[model samples]
Target chain A: DAGITQSPRYKITETGRQVTLMCHQTWSHSYMFWYRQDLGHGLRLIYYSAAADITDKGEVPDGYVVSRSKTENFPLTLESATRSQTSVYFCASFNRESYNSPLHFGNGTRLTVT
Target chain B: QKEVEQDPGPLSVPEGAIVSLNCTYSNSAFQYFMWYRQYSRKGPELLMYTYSSGNKEDGRFTAQVDKSSKYISLFIRDSQPSDSATYLCAMRDSFANAGGTSYGKLTFGQGTILTVHP
Candidate 1:
């Protein structure tokens, strides 16, 4: 009962539509991250939050946006979803205060933007 | 070049065989290393973790970090069919030495897909 969870385990949206993916973690970790995985590119970071109000871009943050208004929730929003954004999105969490902690991830959301 | 590079291997091996996977990084600032195993349509699971330049063995898996050469490796002995999945290598810096910038942020390599056949 104490793990990360993502809503709408599967989703499909039309191109240019606004879509938001939700991530909730019961562990109360201070650090949260979003990553996208494609056919051959593996997992690429989209955005990360160091705390409730501190967020930073990862390697592939151009098409994605994230906000952390609360510690338990970190949501990823695509202002205008495109077909290129149709991929699996994973949410992960870590404890910044714990030195060198491994990330705990959610089951992930399969978003297919047509 | 990617900061961390790993071969996108669809490495196939017979069950009970030993498996070796590796990744190399360009940033020597990395001091912590980790290996994650992910099955199809699932999130990655932390398999092994190592800090500093040495080898740490847990069960049938061994993780080795060679900071001197910026290389990291994972080995699975007597592999099982259930071990088929993607193995990703990730690294982060020791926060105390990151000039207050790094906060357990991980840089990951392109994962290698491994298939253990019966």
Candidate 2:
């Protein structure tokens, strides 16, 4: 498709296990972000990549790791998942070159850490 | 205290009623304001966007941003049953600073869930 795509729309994994969520965008945006949505907290940024091989921590990046090897791909990994990490993960991209452009989001991955 | 605060209302109203949603923020540096709508299991999509301060209207949806009061609002007129969803208010600072620090990040508010019944 022409929009962003997230893999594994739904996932369930045990605590302490490692899991990876994938995000890919066809627009080749310069900025890509990962956010986790939960009740009462809304959407908290986990990690963001400004460009390939450049990433930074966001509001809630303690247990999550992100890497962007290419401009179109930004994957989030939970090295040691916890029950608290059970929430929906969303990936978004933005073309910083344009001030009027808004972030384009994927449907999201529903992850359950049991 | 959070930077952005929203009512998180599970508001119910009859079809054709006027719907008003709002959010308050503590940051004055925020220059771009936005509203996003999310269905039951879908990611949020941008509904309205405004820069700095002022009101922007799009059909039945109107967005108002008042930087002086550090507040923003979204009003839906003649609401429909299909409008049932969660509305989120988000904003962020300028894209970059003098040093060229790109802050393309967004801070979101707790969403307000609304249902319009016929």
Candidate 3:
């Protein structure tokens, strides 16, 4: 119960459709990140938020938008889904104040765009 | 080339066997290294971590980092069937970025899938 959770473990959307994945953490970690895992590219960060209302782009942020309105929630939205967007998306949280805190990840949401 | 590189092996080993996993990185700024175990359909969990260049062991798992060679490894002794899963190597530059952003971000290697058989 004291972990990160992602909604809709699996999702399928048509090309050009909009999709959003929700992420929630119970620990109230200050840093929340969104990563996409593909066949050859391990895990590439899409976006991250240092705190509520503070967000930044990561390695691959194109076509994606993120908002952290609350400390416990960070949501990712795909403006127009493409077939290339089909991959497993993971949400993770880290405690910025804890020097040795390891990132905690939520069960990924598998999204397929066709 | 990618900052981190791993073989992405679907390695198979019999129970009780010794298993080795490795990753090479191009970034010299990385100071903290970590290993994560991910089971099928599950999120990855941190298994071990080491600071700078050194070795750290816990139970049957050992993590080794050689900053000079820009290589890191994970060894599992007496591997069990339950050990079957994908192991990921991750590293980050623990220092603050000059751009005023937190350098707590990690770069991950393509995970190696391992199977321990009975």
Candidate 4:
């Protein structure tokens, strides 16, 4: 209850269907991020939010959308899922005030697109 | 070349053996370095952190960063079976815009999987 949590630990969706991965943190960190992890690629950032209503793209933002309406929640969405998008998604957060603070991550949502 | 490179190793060793893990980066702008340990089906948690260059040790874990070579390393002494997990290296640039929004954004290397057999 005091840490980050992700819903739908595993998911399977058809190509072209929209799917949303949810992330919620109880720490109220100012910075939140979404990353996709795949074999050989490690983890690639999809999007990040500095604060509520402020979001920006990261290394791999194509085809994925993110929004942070509140400081405690950041959700990632695939407008139209593609087979290539099948990967484990992770959400992370950190207190921006502390430059050296490492990110605290959620358990992650495993999304499989077929 | 990718900004960060790490071997996705399934490195296996017997318990009590010293373990070495490393990562190299191509970005000269990166100033902060970190190592994370991830257990099966769990999110990664910070294991070691170093800023810029030099070495820092905590418990049986030591972190080394060489800015000149753009390399970083994590070493574990007298490893235990519980140390078996994936290790990820991450870095972030020092440059932040006037808004100070991108300072926390990190670039990660492919994780190295290590198993310490008991």
User: Residue pairs in steric clash, candidate 3?
Assistant: none
Which digits, one per residue and each the tens of the lDDT, describe model 2 over residues B62-101? 9999999999999999999999999999998887641243
- Estimate the overall C-alpha local distance difference test score of candidate 2: 0.93
lDDT of 4 by residue, B1-118 (tens): 8899999998999999999999999988898999999998888999998889999999999999999999999999999999999999999887463246776888899999999999
TM-scores for the candidates: 0.96, 0.97, 0.97, 0.96
What does the lDDT come to for candidate 4? 0.92
DockQ values, each candidate: 0.70, 0.76, 0.76, 0.80
lDDT of 2 by residue, A9-100 (tens): 99999999999999999998989999999999999999988899999888999988899889999999999999999999999999988886
Which DockQ-derived CAPRI band holds candidate 2? medium
Q: What lDDT is reached at residue A39 by model 3?
A: 74
- In terms of DockQ, which candidate is strongest? 4
Q: What tens-digit string does per-residue lDDT give for candidate 4 at A44-114?
A: 99999989999999989999999899999999999999999999999999987776899999999999999
Q: Write down the TM-score for model 4.
A: 0.96
- In order, the Cα lDDT scores of the candidates are 0.91, 0.93, 0.93, 0.92
For candidate 2, give the lDDT of residue B68.
93
Recovered fraction of real interface contacts per model: 0.63, 0.68, 0.63, 0.84
Candidate 2 residue pairs in backbone clash: none
User: lDDT, candidate 2, residue B97?
Assistant: 44
Per-residue lDDT over A11-92 for candidate 1, one digit per residue giving the tens place of the 0 to 100 score: 9999999999999999889889999988677788899898898899888898788999999999999999999999999999
lDDT of 3 by residue, A4-113 (tens): 99998999999999999999999989899999998788899999998999999999999999999999999999999999999999999998776667889999999999
Kindly give the number of clashing pairs for every candidate. 0, 0, 0, 0
